[model samples]
Target chain A: MATPQLKQTPLNAAHRRMGARMVDFGGWDMPVQYPYGTIEEHLRTRTHAGLFDVSHMGEIDVRGRDAIAFVNRVTSNDASKLVDGQAQYSALTTPEGTVVDDLLVYRFAEDHLLLVVNASTTPKDWEWIRSHKQDEAVELKNMSAEYCQLALQGPDALRILQTLTDLPLSEIKYYHFREGAVDGVPSIVSRTGYTGEDGFEVYAAAERAEQLWDRILEAGRFGETDGVMPCGLAARNTLRLESAMALYGNDIDETTTLLEANLGWICKLGKGVFIGREALARQKEEGVKRRLVGFEVTERGIARDHQDVLVNGERVGQVTSGSPAPYLKKNIGLAYVPVEFAGAGQEIQIDVRGRAVGAQIVPTPFYKREKKQSAGSHQPSAKTQ
Target chain B: MANVPEDLHYSKDHEWLRVEGDVAVIGITDYAQNSLGDVVYVELPKPGEKFEAHESFGSVESVKAVSEIFTPVSGEVVEVNESLSDEPEKVNEDPYGAGWMIRMRMNNPGEVDSLLSSVEYEEFTSAETE
Candidate 1:
């Protein structure tokens, strides 16, 4: 009987030097927050910009003559619709129509693609894909160890990032990416982020991760965007929760289908045949039984994850993720219940401890960045979560 | 490292108590506040509520989690720090001073001698953290 070792990202030393409060997150030793605290770090991301070391996410490279077909067979989203330089939010669903994992697919070309999966579920996702390959024409490589990622997110992200890269970032649309050099380091710059704000995600070699992190921080110090703050996992969790994004283990899991998680938009059933297509199609036609809904605590208590949700004194569901939204100054959470009780403004109660705390279903995302303030002044792009 | 005053008695749960005659002032230790992060809300019991030793009086909510504050000795609450409702950050700023939570009329003064001394409490917290 022995305790397994926790994995550390390349930026672990940097986070320690900055006095970040470290914690074990999903078997990875990562920083939960810096001395600035989660509330301040959260607010900093909303108002200015925040730098996040998201290197723990797994990256798998899919390449070969049948890469496109293989990806199309595994993921719920249509891979054929993704042009070069485009990224799609998709789910790896089981034959039962339940989610295996939600992942981001980056299409570099017809024969080459990148799948970024959750750190905790990477091994499972990789095995599921490898076992289902139709032929040897598709090759899979686990590149998680070769790369590290950084998310520069918020209203000021573009300004901070422009100082390091010579590429025309303004032309890159949301959910799109380009192969370029950032701070003299070869990297893939994607106009994607988990925070509900405008931002870019930079993926670089693991060896160069520390240098790229330092250079990005140095360039962002005291400029037009008023600098960027180093945010940790706690802030990242709160930010994503406020945006009503689904956390794999929490909001959706093996027992929940993609449609039940309210992510049917990514499930393209009519695009030929794929794994789980028949089950998902049947579910869609039969309609979802229980729907995940966003909720705001109306009473004087903070709802917590795993707490029971009651409707008129009967248990309906349980909270998936709950937190005090710093920018919104409200306590919000997500839960799943019967479709009859899923509409916005529907009354519900979250049993915090023994007492029932008043709550109500609200339309997600709880917070949205004004379109005029984001890049290109285009309409705010919606997330699959 | 948190500041633990030498004149106060402490509980294993990280609460500090200062005795002034029959009335005892209580607040969470600095170590507790530091571990809890930014204190956003405080839920306190009514002024006349009575409690037994080690009973939970209320909870303090931080950005990360909620922790219950316990009574170190059985007593009737005489007064509560009302200002904390509007300014919960005071708990993080001065956990032993302006952030004092409640004043209670002690039912057994001898219970103070049984609580951990400041030196013992410091050693306990340091050992727990290590």
Candidate 2:
């Protein structure tokens, strides 16, 4: 018998009210799609705006005199270079250079930082962080259960959020954040998101989240066009896939290294030591044997996880994440392949359900955003920015 | 939910079987297609391949995941669906008629009695959540 799935987010009732199809996602009962369908929700986020209940993600607060130093030693990215109000994408890795989880580290101040980890790995990450914090004076607090995260993503995100806050939305630069109020609810509005589009991630008290969700939906109605709709996990996956954003378990796991996963950019060996710096530096200098490459199926067949990857009739690697990109209307996936076959335009084959289908290596970011205003275009007032 | 034709018999694994003299036609039930979502590919047993009861005969892949198709009874594969290679969605569109996966010469015709009738299959699937 199938075990009952775990808890729901604060917006679970609201999702049902909006006609969402709920599914068990990593043990959390979450919305997979709304009545508008995955394709419609995806296009809305790409062309206009979409709201997402991302409360399932894990959040932790690190604070102390040694917080910055503590974080710099634990994560792969060069965290010491981060300025107040800025955030950087980084990875927490095992001693062997394998990625434990990919996360965002937000520098709230010189002495305080916020780490957002994948939901499934929250418990394990918390334990790992806590164990490593032994000598440091830093206070590690798992604030995941206390806050609800909502992502307002796409082109019109700033416009929709502008109506709710007197703080200038345009002043908040990409990957930067500010404290703001949404319908009387205090929130941390950060110009960051997973969708490779301009957006804001709002962190608010869990109890106040439902009201804020309703207010955002109401605010959308006043726009010149129908504004943002609540999107679920299905469109979220497709949107991230099109952007070539890596999903935690599928694209990179504890068994996969950052270098092999094409995330060497996040590893900064020139800086002081980190958890997996030694292993990562060795892999970087020696060159990765197998590398993750993006591929588009030229023929029919949707390559999926664990499917064998063949190059010149020889099995080399396997697909890690695959899907029929709704936006591109073609089958696309990411796989680990021999470095020789990782270049763009190289021919390859994916064994889909035992049949080899033609595919081609492609550049990352299968979809790109049209040129828009610069990230610097958004800045808050001198007092609040 | 799609209707299960009264003449067909279904196994607990969701395969539907139809007896035509000594030969048996095997395909996935309508409930299986609905649950699997858009069928993108189907792998069928090769002609003349023999299998024991409960052995995996082939597999079907959808956008969401893959599931193995099992043989309900021991048999020798007589033929496989050729059109599915070009039009796999037919399994979702018409699972009973055009989506038939294979035909086999049943080694034990007596095993047919163990398959559920359309009425029993409907009841079995009605309690299942999609």
Candidate 3:
């Protein structure tokens, strides 16, 4: 069989021009890092600002009279609570209460909503959401190709972005968005980001991706002082990992339920009958057997994904996501362990490439944005893990 | 183009070997470090450890992934670069110089004749990247 061609995002040429190292990410020709490297990009996002091309992520528009009803029926979150211009992180749930794909539900109104899903799971999510459609007035349109999304993230992201558009950015609170023009390019400016920073995500037409990208970078460079670094998928992953955000395939999958993934906050199990309510509600009442827990390596080695979690040399669970957090200055990771070993301050062992290394379960949000900035940055952020 | 020093001998696995009298210095090639990206941690074999030709000696961890470094010739490790534990980025910055991983007393000095020359390794790397 012939190998399928890798799909390129609209900003592919710009990435190449910037000397980005490209890799095959889920069959998409995506930049993994720039010449400066992932560690530098990761630190740049934490300290200053970083621009990310997230055009590969899929977007599906749900329209019709039953849009609200259809969305609430198919997803795990309470869409009825989302007002106009409000967005919530949610997931397309399976009948078995597992996640088909974790997504962001942007409610334009009661009759129109846009679901942004993981790039690799876009096709699968579409088929799954469609399979659940049994005589509803809902119309699902896959609009993945027509749009390009960029996330401007960091502590100074707002100051840089404010120069681009007259969107009244500060008025757009956390998790709120507005439709406006960014540097004359039409966009949906949402104050939502994967990195746990005060940032914004812009969704614009695919044809204008390059224009919007260059303008944002320019705005970040406003005076050629606060330049926004172009980051890649590697930095994107590390930033999200530090935030303790659940990655689609790694942190949560078809076999992992919302409650088990520590995403019970998004699970409005009481909101009528949904796709996964039955199984999820049952699990809630019975209590979860295993849970997703954040941890730090107490010893020397770094614990990575798929490595075993051991207790007295006996295998228990596995690490779902792990990395050396450049900002936190320590090795951190997430894993699914038995409930007995999931609490904060609990001790566990990580099989780091066959070496049973010591680890400590810790509270999440490994790096939290400080409410106030001091004179110096000795320990400006709150690190729970 | 990757910097393949004319005097160094290379293995197909991208390790470059520099001989000094009976002692042989070994490290990854420029192409290898460039592909690895942002070295964070390096695991090196201790002095006195022995290995055969084309054997795995140590591992290098970058920000995103881990890769193994192979030894080009058989020998006992005479010295290992200890500075790498604190500063592995040297592997990416100076893979052929300060980044040299280990020094070995050669088991068979004649093995150098079978290794790829600088020009041959350059061609091999160009084809591999393509």
Candidate 4:
């Protein structure tokens, strides 16, 4: 069979001009790295700033009178608790309490919400959301193709962005957002990202994305800014892995439950009924069958996806995502194991390419958190006096 | 793309064999390494294992995918690269040198004639690219 053709992002030309090695990422033709490679990009993002073009991810806008109420019934998180300019990480689950997609719920206002979903699961999520839209007052519009998104991540992300807008970025607390102009292009800058770093995600008109990308790259050339580079899917994956952030298809899928996936925090039992709430409540009461846990290989060999998890030579569960961590310099993976062996520090073995490698369960977020500047110190004029 | 070394014989599967007396040093060609970016792990055949020509020996895994390694010539595996277990990225860095996968005693020295020459392997990979 012929290799699949890749889908182009808005910044394809820019990536090519920068001499990036492009690859097929979930159908999107994205740069896996510049000439410097994934290791450099990974380190750059952790230490300084890195720019990423994540325009391929789908964005849907939920608006109208019953928008908040409608969304509250579809997702695991209590959407009603989100104030304007606040964003909450959530999951959309099936009636059986299995995940449909993990998403970001950005409450722009009381009646307007922006849902950012996984690229591969976009169509299915849209269909599911629309199918459940029974209220005439709710309007669901897919604006994924209309906007382009960029992530500026690292410790210096705030400094680099502050140079462009007079808006006080320090005041935009983590998981909060504001609408403003970047180089005259109206954009929404959100203080949230998947890399577990201090960063901001900028959403702007697709036509203006190239201009914005170039501007940020140019600004990143300043002093103490050698760390800024264009990151591709390779570095993004490793960064997210080190942060213990779950990938949708690998870590949580349509059959994976919020409880089993270790995302119980997103499922609220006290709130009014939502889809999958009863099943999740029952799981909570009776205890879950399997749990997703992080593990580090104690022996040589890299554990990979779909490998079997063995406890005392008995096949118990399976590995979902595994890699030799670039930062930790050890083979680490996420696996679904029996609830008994899921606790941190539990010993286990992962069958890697037919050989069992010794491993021990560890705490989540394998990477350490970097200190961030307080939002009150840099509040934007529109949000403050 | 780097030129395939003229001193080595190539397999259609992209393995390179450098015959030194009765022993052959085996490694993947530059074309293979470039195609399989950033190799993270290499599973080598056990030392003393015997295999026929074109037989599966082990596998090379990258972050994106995994591919089987094929024996270029029927031989008894005499040694495997132990250094690769700790650092597989060497295959991406210097595929022909320290990244060499195995050393084997060739079953028949005349089998080298059936393998491609460096120039032939270059033309073969170039054609495949187009």
Candidate 5:
């Protein structure tokens, strides 16, 4: 039998032209890094701006008189608080309280919202949302292919992005967005990103992706932000992992809950009737079985994802994400363990390929960007979580 | 287009060996380092440890993944690269020189004849990558 070809985004050709080392990421042929390397790209995103082709991420539009209601019903976060032009990081959960997918809710208007989900979970998310509609008048449309997303992330994101649009980007607070024309193309510029740094995500028409990608790269070429690194998914993964942000299939899955993943801040238990609200609320009352914790390897080996975590020579949990953080200059990872071993400074061991390596639980967001004037909304500005 | 030096003996697992008398110096090929991407740490066996051919004697770790380093021929480790403890990037910069991983005394000198030559290794790499 022949293997099926991987899906390609609109920027596929552009990535190849730039000499990217491509990989298959969740069935999508995406660039994992360029010849410049993942470390360079990761650092550049923290110092200067890094342009990313996030077109493979899926987008679904929820429109109707009950759009906000429908979204609030399906997502764990209280979407009713989202005003026009605002966005929120939320998760769609199963009735059993495990995550279907973590997503971004963009409130376009009173009757319309855009849900940005992970690339691999798009089809599942769409079906879950439609099935939960339950006679609601919401119209759901999968717009994953209609728009291409380009993320310009770094401390200089605004300085570079301001040159392209006349819109007052400074006024748009974090988690806020504005519909404007970017390089003569209609676009939705959102002040959000997976990386911990301050950045903007541009959603543009699919046809204009190539030109817009080039134009954004060109615009970011000035003074301090010149030669913006064209980062790939590898850099993005490291960036997010350093921030202690959860990745869907890895950190939080169908078997995990918001409380277990340390995302209780987004679980609004009192938000009233939702798919997983009861289970989540009950779990909250009884306390979680285990809690996710960030750790640093005090030993020689690098702990990798799925490695077992041990406490007192007993297996407690497993690593969800792990890597040698480029900027921190240390090996770090996230793992789920019994609550007793989840505190900072707690001692633990990671079984790296059968060899026990000493590690210690530590406070996360190992790398935090100094905040600029505009503070992000939707969640408490706790630099790490 | 990874470098496969003409004088080195290559293993199917991407290790290169430079034999001198009965002692052989082993290092991962340029192709291996390039594929691994920015090796952050290397776990090497002790100098006295003995291993058979194709046995995992050490491990190489990068920011993305971890790979085991297998010995190309059966031998007793005589010396291990200690500089890599602080300068792991040497594996990426000069994989054939400062990045050489281990030195071992070959238990069976005749085993060298079984390893691939530079030309054969180059062809193998091309075919594997394709």
Candidate 6:
């Protein structure tokens, strides 16, 4: 089959100038790593700050009097509970309780909210939302191409980003956002991250992406090594994996439900009549049969995605996402198994090709950010549901 | 730019062969290591295993991707680099020496002549990067 032309972010030229290895990520030409490599970028993001071009992520604007009602009906979370400037991780679920796409709902006003969906799922999500619109006053616009999202993550994220934006970043609690001028560019500054690190995600107009990117890079480029690393998709994956956050295609998809993927915290079944609520409520009452669990490879091999998960040499399930956790310094992964074998200490095997490798079930969020006393208390930011 | 050692025989697949009598010292080339980034894990065939020329005998996995290590010539594996199991990054640090994957008794040493030389391998890799 012939390949289609890959989409490019506004910062494509900048990435090329930095000598980053570009790859096709969900049909978009994205940087997978720079000359420093994924491991170094991953480590630096944990210790220092890391800049990421996240412009390919889809954005949708939900507006009108029925916006809150419309969002609540389609998403698994209770949007009514969210106040202006707050955000929550939620999912669009099918009637069968399976995920359509996990997204972030940022409430800007009583009748306006911004929905950030995965890059690959933009068109589908738009179609799904438009088709599901019942004679409601809510108007949904796919503004994915109009915005450029950049994440400045890690321990020094605030210190770095604060230089460019006059917004009191530390005052912005986790998962909450504020609209402000960042380096003269209007942007939505949100305290959220996928790396399990306390960080900020800034969204600005797509055309001004290069300017925003350059400003952030210049603001944080301290000395020879004290600066933020310009990270890429490869490091992003490893960082999220170490945090045990679910990747849409790998950990959660149409075949999986919120409960099975361990995202039940975001599934508000009692919020009244949302799609998939009935099925999820039933599952809750009946109890989930299979669940996603984190495991560490006890043996020599690294268990990769799509590898089979076994119990006593019998195939039970497959690894959803697996790799060497750079921060944890061990090979870890998430896999589904029968509820009886889901608890920590349960021995399981991962079929790395034909080899049965020893592994033990462990509690997830494989890595967590340390709470620094000087910064006071900040909410532990949640990832995509 | 990759460091190409002229003393080694290079395979198009990027394996470097150093012939020591009948036993061939084989590992991936400097070009391969530079492209692979950090080596996180190295999976190798046990000693005494036999492999055909151009057949993948093992794999080297980095943080980004996985690459198979193919043999330039058919051989019986006499010794495997067990140290790589613990220190796979040695491949990135020193591809020619400590990262040597295996010592093999080749069925035919003449197959080494069929592989690329230092100049040809460097030319081919430069074209690949372009």
Task: Compare the candidates by TM-score and give the number of the best one.
Answer: 5
TM-score of each prediction: 0.96, 0.82, 0.96, 0.93, 0.97, 0.96
lDDT of 6 by residue, A99-166 (tens): 99999999999999999999999989999999999988988899999999999998889988888878
Fnat values, candidates in order: 0.60, 0.20, 0.73, 0.27, 0.67, 0.87
Error of 2 at A364 (Å): 0.8
lDDT by residue (tens digit), candidate 1, A134-197: 7648789999989999999988888889889988887888888999989899999999888888
**Compared with the true structure, what per-residue lDDT tens digits does model 4 show for residues B1-130?**
7659989999989999999999999999888987777788888888989999999999997765688999888989999999998888889899899999999999998998899999999899999977
The DockQ of each candidate is 0.74, 0.23, 0.84, 0.45, 0.78, 0.82
Which ten residues in a row are the worst by lDDT in model 1 chain B?
A: B57-66
Better of 1 and 4 by lDDT: 1
lDDT of 5 by residue, A1-385 (tens): 9877999999999999998989999999999998888998999999888889999999999999989888998999999999999999889988888899999999989999999999999999989988888878889999999989999999878888888898899988999999998888899999999888898999998889999888878887722434577898889989988888899899999999888888888887788888899999999999887988899999888888999999999999999998988888888998999887878899999999889999999887676778867566543221223
Best of the two (3, 4) by DockQ: 3
Error of 2 at B25 (Å): 9.9
Where model 6 places Cα greater than 4 Å from the true spot, the runs are A373-385
Per-model TM-score of chain A alone? 0.96, 0.95, 0.95, 0.94, 0.97, 0.97
Model 5 residue B26 CA deviation (Å) reads 0.4
Share of reference contacts kept by candidate 5: 0.67
Clash pairs, model 6 backbone: none
Global lDDT of model 3: 0.89
DockQ-based ranking: 3, 6, 5, 1, 4, 2
lDDT of 4 by residue, A1-385 (tens): 9977777778999999887878777788888887666776888898888899999999999999888889889999889999999988888989999999989999988889999998878889999999988854888999998999999999889888887887778888888999998878899999988787889999999999999998887788722547478888888888888887889999898889988887887888788889999999999999988988888999867888899999999999999888867777777888998888888889999987678889999887778664644532221100000
Q: Which residue pairs in candidate 2 have backbone atoms (N, alpha carbon, C) closer than 3 angstroms, thus clashing?
A: A170-A378, A170-A379, A171-A378, A171-A379, A171-A380
- For model 1, residues B1-130, the per-residue Cα lDDT tens digits are 7899999999999999999999999999999999999998898999999999999999999877899999999999999999998899999999999999999999998899879999999999999988
* Model number with the top DockQ: 3
Q: Supply the TM-score for candidate 1.
A: 0.96
- Give all candidates' CA lDDT scores: 0.89, 0.85, 0.89, 0.86, 0.89, 0.90
Compute the DockQ of candidate 5: 0.78
DockQ of 4: 0.45
The true-versus-predicted C-alpha distance at residue B122 of model 5, in Å, is 1.2
Question: Which regions of candidate 1 deviate over 4 angstroms?
Answer: A222-225, A373-385
DockQ of 1: 0.74
Residue B88 of model 3 has an lDDT of: 86
